[model samples]
Target: SQKIEQNSEALNIQEGKTATLTCNYTNYSPAYLQWYRQDPGRGPVFLLLIRENEKEKRKERLKVTFDTTLKQSLFHITASQPADSATYLCAFNDYKLSFGAGTTVTVRA
Candidate 1:
């Protein structure tokens, strides 16, 4: 079966700095990649999506990069603030969206 993995550990960072997250995949080549932010109890809210051929995509302070050659993706949040803290998920399009475990981020004032 295919698998997508993100660091389960919570990341802590100071305010005004960038927060980076990583997603690794195996056993499949997806058509596109999507990112979302989830609160502790709520469902994930879509952020950005990048195609297999797209090297990078951005929206405001959020940036996403996909590398089919490396079978990995990188997600970045610039000038992070306390409000930016949340669990970030990486999903792939394979007739449907398959999600990773999600990585939590925390920003301190």
Candidate 2:
């Protein structure tokens, strides 16, 4: 069985600072990992995706790192703002897609 875990507690950070989130998995080897952001009542918006062979990937102010050996992934948001505040989710695909519980980020101005 595969399990994914993210920070269940809310993450509070000051605006303009960087925020980092972690995703850990057990008993799984995914081909790729993806991150998404969901607002209060909206569907998740795709952020970044990193493949197993890739060590790091970046898009705008977002960055992601995938380490197969450690079975973990790290998601980063640089120069975060209030607009960036949302529940971030980590998902992976082996033969099927699975999602984490998600971590809520609150960027205070």
Candidate 3:
């Protein structure tokens, strides 16, 4: 009965600032969580993955935090640029696999 939720609105931010997006779910236990970035009219591209046992993970300008107890995952982009603007998705595979609604980020100078 777990359900996932992401920001449905577009996020607009100034260049050089960080953008934070959120994913929250309830009522289920997940083994792993994956994040992906998708551009308009293009397929999603993988960003990072965090296992259920991992609390925090970072890769370059990206960071992810997974809290199994709270059933939440946070995705961050540091020193964001216009090129980083895209829809960010959080997904986890169970039997059928599921994805969040995705949050679109727009960075402007």
User: What is the alpha-carbon lDDT of model 3 when measured against the actual structure?
Assistant: 0.92
| TM-score for candidate 3, residues paired by index | 0.94
lDDT of 2 at 32: 88
Q: Cα RMSD to native, each candidate?
A: 0.8, 1.0, 1.1
**lDDT per prediction?**
0.94, 0.93, 0.92
Q: What is the lDDT of residue 3 in candidate 3?
A: 84
Per residue, candidate 1 scores C-alpha lDDT tens digits across 6-73 of 98788999999999999999999988999999998999999999999999999999999999999999
Candidate 1 residues lying further than 4 Å off, grouped into runs, are: none
Could you tell which candidate, 1 or 3, scores higher by lDDT?
1
TM-score of each: 0.97, 0.95, 0.94
lDDT of 3 by residue, 1-109 (tens): 6788998888999999999999998877889999999999999898899999899999999999998887899999999999998899999887766899999999998
Give the number of colliding residue pairs in candidate 1. Answer: 0
Error of 1 at 7 (Å): 1.3
Which clashing pairs does model 2 show? none
Candidate 2, 18-71: lDDT as tens digits = 999999999888888999999999998888889999999999999999989999
Of candidates 2 and 1, the better by TM-score: 1
